[model samples]
Target: MIVKRITNVFFRYALRVITLLFAVSVIGFTLVSLSPVDPVQQYVLSVGSVSPEQRAELEDYWGLNDPPVERFENCLSAILHGDFGTSLLYRRPVIDVIREKFANTFALMLCAWVFSGVIGFILGCVMGANRDRAADKILKRICLLLCSVPTFWLGLLLLLLFSVWLGWFPIGFSSPIGVMNSDVTIWQQIHHLILPALTLSLLSFANVALHTRQKLIDVLESDYVLFAKARGESKRQIMKRHGYRNIIMPALTLQFASFAELFGGSVLAENVFSYPGLGSAVSAAGLNSDVPLLLGITLFSALFVFTGNMIANLLYGAIDPQIKESYANE
Candidate 1:
């Protein structure tokens, strides 16, 4: 029975992951295909010295003369083989360029996730325990106010306050713009990261705190909680031994899902801070009509979000046994 349940859960999400990937890929390909901008023309203009014959050859090399369906088929085949094609803009493989940029984005997102999650979950537990009191009311009001503000606006405000006004952080990427400083120390790297990470963390904190507090509040008032209290457990003991277990699964699911959504939408925060992450690269690709790089980033970002959702689903099922049974019928 345990094996059957596990198999069912795994199969359900496996199918979901496959379906989502297929849908994302098809949508990305279709949109890029329909764009009136010509990638070959963009490439020719950037390269600056090609005869008409060379231009025709370049188009033929990219399978531009082939039927649309055929071109898509070839692209699909290359993508399946882990070749995301070569970038005309950067003169490198799209996969290689994206890998470098994605690492930067991943590091930025990781720091933001950790900072927000730990602080938010702690505050949530406190607020849940002290419902309707001054602290809870103030925190709730603050969360609501922050949530009303746009992410980009908040990011810019933080940047101005910290970097421009106080001069606490450098205003841009790790090194100077377009210059790589291989000798940048660990401390310098962390210094460069602080403002942008904080900006993103602030944007993320409210959701996790709000959802966790609500879930914890419900758990605190349940029959088992009351029974535990009746059986001589202190409020602290009841919460530690019973309440948290019941609440954490849902709260955790919310956190992971939010983390996924935030990573995908963090372009604005990264861009506003002049952070040399994938966000800037993606923007450049769009403006230049760099098809390969643009498509690579799109697919990579979709995969990251999908993977996060997968982790949330799996973890929720693992911690809350009822989740599998509940989802089984669905």
Candidate 2:
């Protein structure tokens, strides 16, 4: 029965992924096709005036003269074969360019996620446990204020206060002098990440705290919780074993959605900090009208969102036996 249930889950996940990939491919192709500027023309303009023969040759090389549907089909084929095509601006394979910058973005995202989830969860649990008290009210107000603040503005404020005024860390990308200095160790790398990570974490933390507080409040009000309380279960035991456990699935759902927002949000943060991440790379690609690079970044981001949601669904089953049983029945 467990094997059957797992197989069904895997099948559903695969179907969803395949459908999402197709949808993304269609949307990407459509958007690119509808753009007024021809990539070939843009390339020609960037390269200065070219002879008619040179223009034709460039178009032929890029297969730009091919029918739109044929071009899209070719693109899909290339993507399926793990060939992301070449970037017009960089003159390099899109996959290679993305791979080079992925680590920086991943590191920043991981730090932000950890800080947001851990801190936010703890604060939220405290507030929820306290319920209508002064501490709960204060925490709620703080989270609301944090949510209202713009991420970019907050990032700038942190940059000015910490990096500029205090002289605590380098202001920008992996040290303007490069990462090779003997003084620049792993701890130094983490120190530099502090501002950007904090800036990114603020919004995520607020979201998690708000969601967790709401979910915990709802869970605490449930009949099972009340019954446990009546049975003389200690508050700590009830919260730890029942309340927190039940809230985990909902929290995981919100976290998955946050992953999508983080990619776009990180772009602004990366710009402010001059971080050498995929967000910065995407921004550069957009400015340069590097279609392949832009597509690569977009597709990569889509993949992240898709995979995160899948993991969240699986986690629901693991954390909530009721959810697993319901799925098994289906």
Candidate 3:
């Protein structure tokens, strides 16, 4: 029975993912198809001058002369086989370009997630533990204000203060320009990472702190929690064993969502700092009407979101037996 239940759960999520991907692919392809910019023509224009014969050859090679439906089908088939097609802009395989850039983006995102989730989680726990106090209220209000601030503006502000004005960290990209010396240690690498990571983390901190505070308040105020308090349990003990445990799943959900958001949100920060991440590549692709690269990036983002949720849900089930039992019952 347990095996059947797990299988059912897996099947359900699998079907949903397949359907979601299919729909996203169709919508993405349809939008690209409807656009006035022609990849073949764009390529020809970029080459300065191309004869009619060459233009026809390029169109045929890209399947540009094929019907929209046929082209889409071919794209889908190629994707299923791990071929994202040649990037019209870079004249390279989309997979190769994406793979190289993904490492940088992944590193940036991982750093951002740690900065946001760890710092925000700790700050939120303090706020929640001190709920209704002046300090808690003040922090909450401050977070609310920060939440309203635009992300791009915050990134630029960080760049101005830290990079331009203070001259502390390097202004752009993950690495140095020419060569690595004694000054270019891992510590130096982190120095470059800090500004962009912090810029995004500040915004994530607002949301994390708010979500955490609410979850902790609910957990702390629960009847069981009150009973423990009345039984002369220490605040730390009660919080460690009960309050924190209850809040962990919800907090995990929040962090997972933020993890996905970190990737999507990094686009602005990357472009601002000239970070060689997926977001920067994506923005350039869109501007140049590089449909293949744009589509590839979109698919990567979508997959990341789905993967994050899947991992979160799995952890949720492990943390909460009730959720597992509910799934089994279903």
Cα lDDT listed for each candidate: 0.82, 0.85, 0.86
Q: Which stretches of candidate 3 lie over 4 Å from their true place?
A: 1-10, 51-57, 180-185, 326-330
Residue 176's lDDT within candidate 1 is 45
Write down the TM-score of every candidate. Answer: 0.89, 0.92, 0.91
Per-residue alpha-carbon lDDT of candidate 3 for residues 1-330, written as tens digits (9 for 90 to 100)? 888877877998999899988988999889888888578776876788999998888888878889989988899999999998778888899988899888888878888888878877887899999999998999999899889988789999999998899999899988877755455677666777888888878878889989999899999989999999899999999999898888878988889877666876789888988988898999988888888898998888888888888888888887788987776667
Per-residue accuracy of model 2 over 1-330 as CA lDDT, tens digit each: 889877877898889888988888789878977876467776887789899999999889888889998999898999999999888877889988888788888888889998899898888888888999999999999999999999899999999998899999779885446557566777777877788888999978998998899899999999999999999999999998898888877877888778887887899999999988899999988777778888888888898888887888777777788887777677
lDDT assessment of candidate 3? 0.86
Q: Give the clash count for each candidate.
A: 0, 0, 0
Q: Sorted by lDDT, highest first, which candidate order results?
A: 3, 2, 1
* Pick by TM-score: 2 or 3, better one: 2
In candidate 2, which residue ranges exceed 4 Å CA deviation?
Answer: 1-4, 45-49, 176-184, 328-330
- What TM-score number comes out for model 3? 0.91
| Model 2 TM | 0.92
Better model by lDDT: candidate 1 vs candidate 2: 2
The positional error of residue 89 in candidate 3, measured at the CA in angstroms, is: 2.2
Residue 246, candidate 3: C-alpha displacement in angstroms:
1.1
Candidate 1 achieves a global lDDT of 0.82
